[model samples]
Target: MAKYEAKMKETESSVIEFIETVENPKKREDAYKLLEIFSEATGYEAKMWGPSIIGFGSYHYKYASGHEGDAPLVGFSPRKAKISLYFATGDTEREVILERFGKHTSAKACVYINKVADIDVEVLKELINRSIKFLQETYGS
Candidate 1:
């Protein structure tokens, strides 16, 4: 495996093992399904960003402001309280989704949801795809 994939594997294996041991079978299944959906939708191999996030794809980015790094194209971490989906746009320009999404919260660049059923997965994919295109056009990723 490549270095990044190897590192992610080492991290994500622990996460999958932890999830398997959890008390809630439903949550574990849901998380696994989410991983599958995201993996298929993004067409990126599954890799762990950390203990909880199963990330798909990888890209290198550098801003004109002299900031640059590599990051996953799509990622999510299933936590005890919620699942956090990682994307570039959070609240600044996603007013449409803000009104459409069932019940979700956000930070500067991530979306927090109680469950996948709570939001429109198709719409979410559109947003992610659009964001990726935008990033590529803007940053040449």
Candidate 2:
């Protein structure tokens, strides 16, 4: 089999510039606020992942099938419709926190909220720390 390549690799793009390009005023503001929250929670500087995501910290993982790649430990993107939160999946603590996270929808890999105010910031911080811990335990940083 050919080697697999991850599409969402980190880039040198300016995160502030990317946030400035967000067309939605509310989403743009939320992006800045999330930047602050994620930084304070993870204690890692924000980085631009691919073109759209504002990420903090990173880790490498290899699946059972040998698919391996580096990804941000925690991140968020202020998309057109909703802010997509990226966190480690399959974490039970994350699932538990989501119950009290307020109005939001979740997918297999991401949590979607209309805005930062829609969710409990404390829960969000817990989720961020939990994700970082889970990833560091599962895959060394």
Candidate 3:
């Protein structure tokens, strides 16, 4: 059987150059802040995922049906509307942190925020730590 794959694979693309292309100046600045935060929290050098996402660490995941692929443990994309924070989707601690995360919207796996200043940095750190821990526990580095 053919192996499963993810479209959002890591790339050698320059993250700085990608951030530089963000039309919004504030989003560009926030992208840099997120890069620093995710890098410091995960202790992983950032890499570009696909064309836009700035990913930190990565892990392999296989489902019961055997579909599997590598994915970033934590990452973010500075979109025009909001910053999409990629985190452990089902983590209860993540939900708790998000409650206090300050002015953000969340979906199944992505948290949307307008700016870093719109959220609490300490809570953001906690979320990043929790996501790294959860992902590492679920899928080893």
What is the alpha-carbon lDDT of model 3 when measured against the actual structure? 0.89
Candidate 2 to truth, TM: 0.97
lDDT tens readout by residue for model 3, 1-141 = 666567899999999999999999988999999898888888989999999889988888878887888888889999988999999866888887888899999999999999999999889989988998998888875
Q: Between the candidate structures 1 and 3, which one is better when assessed by TM-score?
A: 3
| lDDT (10s digit) by residue, model 1, range 91-139 | 3456565567678987876789887778887777766776566566665
For candidate 3, the TM-score is 0.94
Q: Provide the global lDDT of candidate 2 against the true structure.
A: 0.93
Residue-level lDDT for 131 in candidate 3: 92
Cα RMSDs, all models: 5.1, 0.9, 1.4
Model 2 C-alpha RMSD vs. true structure (Å) is 0.9
Error of 3 at 34 (Å): 1.1
Best by TM-score: 2
Q: How many steric overlaps does candidate 1 have?
A: 0
Q: Provide the overall lDDT of each model, using Cα atoms, as 2-decimal numbers.
A: 0.69, 0.93, 0.89
